[model samples]
Target: MMMRIIYPILGMVMAFTSVLHAQSARITALPLQKELKLPASFETAVEKIQYDLLENENGESRIEVVDENCLHIQFIFSTDKAVKQDDWQVSVTPAFSPSFHWAPHLTPTDRHIIDQHVFRSPALIMADGRQVITLIPDLDIMKKGTPVRWYLDLDAEGNRLVLGMSNSRVDDHVLFVREPGAEYPAGEVEIGFYLMVNRDEPSLKNPFRRPLEFLWKRWGHGLYQDGNPVDADLERYVEHTYNWAFNSWAENVWQEFELNGNKVGAPVFIVNYTQSPNYPGEVNEREFRSVWNQAWFSSLRSAGGLYRYAKRTGNTDLMEKALLTKELALSFPQVEGFFYGLIGTEMHEVEIDGKKYNRSKGWDTHYWGNSNRNPYTWNAAESPFHILDMSWTALLMLRWYDELEKDERLLRYAEQYAGSLLGIQSESGFFPGWLDLHTLQPMAHLNESPETSMSATFLLKLYELTGKQEYKEVGLKAIDAIIRDVIPSGRWEDFETYWSCSRYGSDYLVGKKVARNDMYKQNNFSMFWTAEALLESYRLTGDRRYLEWGQRTLDEMLMTQASWQPPYMYVNVLGGFGVLNADGEWNDSRQSLFSELILQYGKLLDSDEYNERGWAALKASFVMMYSPLNPVTKAQWEKVYPFFGKEDYGFMMENYGHGGRTNAEGEGMGEFTIYDWGNGAAAEAYNRILDKFGKIK
Candidate 1:
């Protein structure tokens, strides 16, 4: 019996051997290709020879040949990915008869191919046996703004495959291929590549488009009249606003009033308009402008000064202003050292040509009137709660001082100020938000709350810049107190929680409270300030908890929306209805209905809804008060109106016309006559938003 032995051809051998010569050839110009055998199973049958110029699957033009045993190929097109002469690989395969079934084997694994500055590997293989190869190059040395490239080789039977090439510069590239066979070169191939580049440029357009110019254009020109350019009037308004805040205001109250005896005027005490009854009680008809206490004015002036300075110089020109404000604030009457809060003291009465008018009532007895009454004093060992005003003022001073290049005089003052406050911190990390100015006794009634958190935030700043352990310790204590007490008690539960201590009846004193409007009353400024404090504290201590708490608080505040009324009016909803009727209306408060809403919504929190709401309110308020025109120039405007309409303006004038004026009734009655705190507050809110998100010119 004759037995025929059949030996199964191991396709593994073909794979291992087929690429051996190609690998050797890459390292050296050796004749390794000559030693390799073109497997008989891998056949190239030349029924016909064809010369064709074709673009390779890589988007490159190449010369190709067709024959029985193999199809020879040469590339002509060049790209960044095209392989250099030294990186090329070549393979050959023997022809097989048409009747013989020859299947080239492909093993997909984590193996990689390295070329000149490029590394290639297979990422995936489809169920149909199509190999996806990825190419990557060294990124460190790659030049910017360059294109990338790639190349591939196929055997005549297409049984053997080689990949090589270069392009601009890329991290990786990919190509897909099916199992090689006699018809390999004829099969479809796919190449995939990716690139990323940067395109950045500066522009002159206002990024934030603060309604400043827009409002001016709308009202300054022909918005009300027939035809007018209005640009001139708009420019005047811009200049006036800038000059008032930066130049005139800064130079006059901020800079002119120096601690070195150039005092502009005596420090005055003013009443909380809400707490006091209207002037000329029942019969006397006179317009009046609510005056703020010296400390309050100083704070306002300093803030305005800083804003103006930053705008004009792109630097801290307000350092002097801050220092002056601090000094004058420290010298406030009634309160010995630093003014704890707004004091309602009788300074002078409205007089015409030296005639004495009705004496004004004293309103300087309490801070926030009924809520906090602690005088501004810090007793190292006794004060129950550390007052935050002193610390905040000191912090603002220090920050401005540092920005102003660390003037030794300012630093010395700051150090002294910071040290005095630091002495009052308790071992348990509690500080008072109010204290007796002369006795240095902590006002326990104020309670140790997030108000201290505000102070602690500033203390952290002092520690960071001065490397003072005491400040840091005090700051940490403040932070601890808030974390342990305030946060746990949900002091930040809602807008109302921000001012947990202040409430009228059941509602917090925010805007005019309408029973329907649940918006919490309180200064939204605290919201941004608290966030800033938390973020700054996190940076100083590198504590994860600080960051986490800050982020959480921020998230909560962002989700809460302010309540709104007719004409799309919005007021940052405070606790509940107190002064305003059920409809959210208020007749007693001087605050704008939506001042806090405008301040908190879009600017600090990045809420598009709030931003739109704020814009709408601003527009409505402008139209209601200012007739959308320049009062002085009588020019038609398009953007913003500085003052209200003539009638409204007349009302405002009358409201402020205490000496010899009649009380008028109507929107214009108390309009411009009385400087609406809401308008200033809203302006402040707008300013803050611009400062935070407005584009730098």
Candidate 2:
């Protein structure tokens, strides 16, 4: 690279960014070409070069070569900077890009690949295998965590590419793109990102495996004596997330809510179970449960989190919370016949489409999963019916009845819930994501994500409890259906990187081979469950193919883990989100589950290969902790007080690596978030691992 310099604090230069085998150098860029156009309010005098445009003219766009070595391009969108809403798009190509093979949506059947604008992280993958990844790190899907998103697409062709981001203007979430046909008034919006082009050996493939392994060895997190690969461990992280989230869970337990002018005390619940501290100038409070019905999994997620943690650790206090959470889940309204679920809360009045709808006034909005962010007008017909919630809720109840205290108060509900799941199974083993809330029948559109695998694992567990042959049959059928979609070779290979399961299969319902819109793409939830199904199938059915499939998928996942060592270990790859976004963003939702599954399979299969890789992956969860290295700034800090904890000592962050630069709102950079999703999963994974293996030293 250029002349090496020591970090002001570290006191020494550590050849941190050097590429051993690759001939890449990020030298101090040469003097900019005189013809290069810059942003309106741009300023940079020190080592780094920066440009800014508070407001922009219509049709105004600029691209400049900032670094000749990496062929880095500066992408800018000209618009009014005062507009606080996110509505802008930016895309720039490296010097040698040709066409794009945008990844295929992860549908189980009739998967279609395309050459269109992609999400979260945008990158230019050269035909020769070189990849130039564009990063808008601050615009992560999670408002608090680093953001990574998929654009609906402004341009489908390779001539242009646009990335997606939420709160681009309001919170300085940079990578920005608007919904298809959704227009913004001519206004101010500042969105920018960095493009890194290098032959750093795209990590997941067979030939590209060296770089990821190399990164961990050289750059892995080490606050201890030596920065060994082992130091990027999962044991400590499990404790961090589990303990913190448990406290929050306990604190938010509302004993009652005012319903019909009466204080009800039956269903104990958490208010801030899935919210981040609101940023400054943001009026949204994170603790309102408005459209939670769309993402019913939130309740099950919290309960399951507490339950798993309590089960793993035998914590009496947590056990009480777990039981209470589940008891509240039992109180959730369910539709007859097929057994649909609800948000376990009331819906207040909301206005939409000139009509008032059931909703509650709150700040809850959608980021990921098919949930109505707008509680006022959230229509069930327009949203996804999350079956995974039903599955987990049943599992929670069953465990309460069978494994834990054997409480029959919840057992009747558990039996009915599990029975409903069985009744809804398609004779052909198909389960659509969008289903009729009442009949448990396929809704208008039959989904393609084929959540057969996800449901299969839950059913298998029920079969063990009741020894029901029908449950076993349904579970086996689901697994078989999932195995049918396994693309044997090529890019998808052993793992479902490009195509597998999804959170929504509504695209298939519309006869669209690709997703037109979404809750989340390339979901980690689907990936983890699929792998778990494979392993569980092996254990229950003694199918060696299932075992091999699980091993192969985990092996590929280990290779694809995108992580950074040292000063940047927080973004290190943790087999967390296998979204396989070429731009290298880490979405840690359910990541710990994937890691935990890998660990379980490793131990049972007696495969040290899986065991070692799994721990490294799980330990990487701890590596996700927030530190002083994040981009969240002082002005943003003023926006969130009681919410933001010790700046240096923080919780797990997900969907990161996209925020290499952009800051919070008008501030310099945004801070990392403390997501309950990451925390809950971390706690559960931690407890289970500790219960079985004891604490790692």
Which residue ranges in model 2 land beyond 4 Å of their true spot? Answer: 1-283, 290-317, 337-370, 373-384, 399-403, 408-412, 486-521, 555-560, 563-587, 605-609, 622-654, 657-676
**Model 1 over residues 1-697: C-alpha lDDT tens digits?**
1111111112224333121111221232224324433344431221111111112222221212122211223322233333222122222221222111110111121122221121111111001111111111212122221122233332213333343332221111211222211111233322222110101110011111222212222222222223221112222222333333344222211123333454422222221222112222221212211223211232443344344444555555444443444454443332333333332323345666665554434323212221122232222122222355555556655765665445565456556666667666677676655555447677534355556666777778878887879788778777776667544223432212222222232333322222211222223224444555666677777887776566444322321211221111111111101111111121112222332344353454475444443443332222222223333212211122223233222111111111111112222122221222322223333344345445211
How accurate locally is residue 14 in candidate 1, as Cα lDDT from 0 to 100?
Answer: 39
| Candidate 2 C-alpha lDDT tens digits along 1-697 | 0221111101112212221111112321232222222332121101122222222332222233334212222222334433333333344333343232233222121112111212222222222244433322222222233222223232223323333333321111222222223233343333333333334443212222232333333333221124322353344455545454444332332333433343322212122313333322322223223222112224444455566666656788766655555554555555562333443333356555566544334213212223332111254334445565556556656655664467676666766766766766666675655454435466543344434566777778777877888877888888776666531221221112222222133223223323222212333345456677778778888878777666555543443443332122233343334353222244444455566676686678686545555665555454445433222322234343434554223344444443322223422122333343444445555655665566654
lDDT of 2 at 436: 49
Predicted structure with the largest lDDT when compared to the true one: 2
Candidate 2 residue 620 C-alpha distance from true site, Å: 3.9
Tell me the lDDT of model 2 at 119. 28
Q: Looking at candidate 2, what is the lDDT of residue 665?
A: 40
